[model samples]
Target chain A: MDIVILLYKGFTALDVVGPYEVLSRLPNAVVKFVAKQKGIIESEYSSMKMVATHTLEEIENADILMIPGSTTAFLNVVKDAETLHHVQRIDATTQWTISVCSGAVLLAAAGLLKGKAATTHWGLLDMLSKFGANPVAERYIQHGKIITAAGVSAGIDMALYLTKAVAGEAYAKMVQLIIEYYPEPPINISDFSAVPKEVEEAARAFFKKEMMKMNIAAAAMN
Target chain B: MDIVILLYKGFTALDVVGPYEVLSRLPNAVVKFVAKQKGIIESEYSSMKMVATHTLEEIENADILMIPGSTTAFLNVVKDAETLHHVQRIDATTQWTISVCSGAVLLAAAGLLKGKAATTHWGLLDMLSKFGANPVAERYIQHGKIITAAGVSAGIDMALYLTKAVAGEAYAKMVQLIIEYYPEPPINISDFSAVPKEVEEAARAFFKKEMMKMNIAAAAMN
Candidate 1:
């Protein structure tokens, strides 16, 4: 499988890293980090630098096309009509289009998810409808060739699900075991619903501004 | 705080990245990717290349020194006596030293965990006892200045705990919410005890050979 992952400035590293870890494990899978240019691109949150393997023009005939989300400048990039046009062109030829967190917003911005069901990070889920998508707030959602996962770390679930869908379940299970992905947390604070009211409120407040911007951007694109 | 994270060829991208996303969020925390040399280092599992910002010789007076785990070949680099000696020298000056997964083994080999309670990737937890550490099969273990987290993804939890311990609970909670780390998985297969017997057995079979090599390397270092 030839996978092309979009690496934009300010993307959440986990959003890209989680899926990359799983997809690259496939025996014959070829994963490419496609960016606006080839070289170092800095993520907004942590200032971690990722090296891009290929430029956007070099990526062609990919089995999977993935877009990872960011809290800072990713929305601005997706809102660019020219970039969205380029993504739309790529989506037309890709076998499967996948996204994590608000990356679904980019797919929706490209008019790929019109009238289709999709998902995004929970904080931004309600805004997905603005992009003409029937938003489903789940960890992982599959609507035909378009697959979206919720939040930053949920990309792992989406990747595993995609692995099962494209490769076999046996391969996906093997990858899961190899990564040792058993979720035993010391505290039960993983889900907003499970956490304290104050924690949830704080989280909502933290992301409210970004969600609003994404909502506005999705509407403008639609 | 000046934090230097060792970046080696074939290191697990998430093992470093998960903690990086959290640690870099701290106010006045300057995190640098320190490698043997400065340039791009390809991760073992994902093959994602990251650019190192500084060389090992450039790192001075680090408040925290972090080492991330990797696959077999990458893990072997840490076991090298010269590398261990360098790590030991750095550990002596750093206020706190930490490792994720088999990174603990490197600390042990450097004689940094001689009397510390430590842990590593659960699959290879048994090897820690050989390095004079009282190994615990937990997700995150902190014995004073030496902290160790279990396999690949657990680095995030360890980082959050460290953030709370150093910065304060409120700050860590804020960062956790911003990252939206409330994990809710459709499957409960993150640990050997939670996963199927067949899956556990298959993983053990696959990893046994690597674990044996780690044991031999640790013995040689001692």
Candidate 2:
């Protein structure tokens, strides 16, 4: 299976890396990172870089199409005409289209999630509707060929589900065993009330501030 | 807080990114990726690269020191005198010395984990004994300044714990909420019996075969 992951400057590394750890190890799975050009693509945090071996023009179709969202960079990416064009083109050719976190925004921008239920990072869930998507807060949503995962960490769960969809439950379980993905998060994140209201407010405030910064940057870029 | 993460060729990307996503958001936190030399460090699967901003010699101490392990490349890293010496040297001044997966082997090689309860990838748990580490098959272990996390995915949990330790519980909870780290894995990876025997056998065998290949490659490099 040719699993091509889209690489954009300032993309979140974990969104790609989490799924890569699971899908790359699949039997005969060929995972490729593709961007506008073949070179080093630095993630948004300025902490990590991923090599894109192929350009968007080089690969037109994939068995699995993965689009990872950046914490702040996704703002700029959605406005890139070439990128959305490629996403729209690839979505037409791919068997499965998967988006992580705010990556659903890009998919929605490409008109793939129009009149479909999808999920994105809880903090940025409101933005999905601006692109005409009915946002659902879930770990992952599988509606036909489209699979959208929530937040940065949900990519692993989404990928495992994708594995089960493509291969079988046994194969997906094998991949899970290899990663040893027994999660023990320190706090309950699913239920909003589980976290203190003040802390949650601070978290939302922080996200809003970052998104504002990203919006300004995106406006300048465009 | 100055958090320095060691980056070497063949290191796992998520191992560093997971911790980074948590720690970088800390109030007044500065995270740096350092290597033997400042350059692009490709991850184990060859899917991603991280830019090491500081040379190991330039950064002598860290508030928090993080080391990520490779499935095969860690063998070479454990034997690399400069890396072990740097690890030992930095550990002397750091408040917390942490290792993820086989990274504990590197820490053990640095003489930091002797008689310490450390953890690593389950497939190579027995090898921890060679480094004089009391291998514990747990998600994360904290023995004084030394902290070890099991496997690839466990790094996130370890980092959150570190966040709570460094910051307060409320701050850590805020960071957790920001990431929306709601994990819902498909299978139980903690208990070996939770999975099928043949799948477990395949996982073990696969790790063994890859280690053998890595062993050969390390021999050639040395």
TM-scores for all candidates: the values are: 0.88, 0.94
Tens digit of lDDT per residue, candidate 2, span B1-222? 889999999887777777787888878888888999898778887756668989999996789999998778888887799888998898899999898888888998888888999998877787788889899888899999888998888899989898888888888889887777768886555565567888877776777777677555323221
Model 2's CAPRI class? medium
Q: In model 1, which runs have C-alpha deviations exceeding 4 angstroms?
A: A204-222, B208-222
In model 1 chain B, which range of ten residues has the least summed lDDT? B213-222
Error of 1 at B177 (Å): 2.4
In candidate 1 the C-alpha lDDT for residue B36 amounts to 79
| DockQ scores of the candidates | 0.49, 0.62
| Per-residue alpha-carbon lDDT of candidate 1 for residues A1-222, written as tens digits (9 for 90 to 100) | 788888888888888888888788776888888887898888874448998888887765688999998874666886688767768878888889999988988888889999998988766776688889999867778888989888787888788888877767766776777776665544446566665667666656656655565565433222
- Cα displacement (Å) at residue B53, model 2: 1.8
Clashing pairs in 2: A10-A44
Candidate 2: share of reference interface contacts reproduced: 0.70
**Clash list (residue pairs), candidate 1:** A10-A44, A181-B190, A182-B190, A182-B191, A183-B190, A190-B182
Model 1: native contacts recovered, as a fraction? 0.43
Off by over 4 Å in 2: A215-222, B188-190, B215-222
Error of model 2, residue A114, in angstroms: 0.9
Error (Å) of candidate 2 at residue A190 is: 4.8
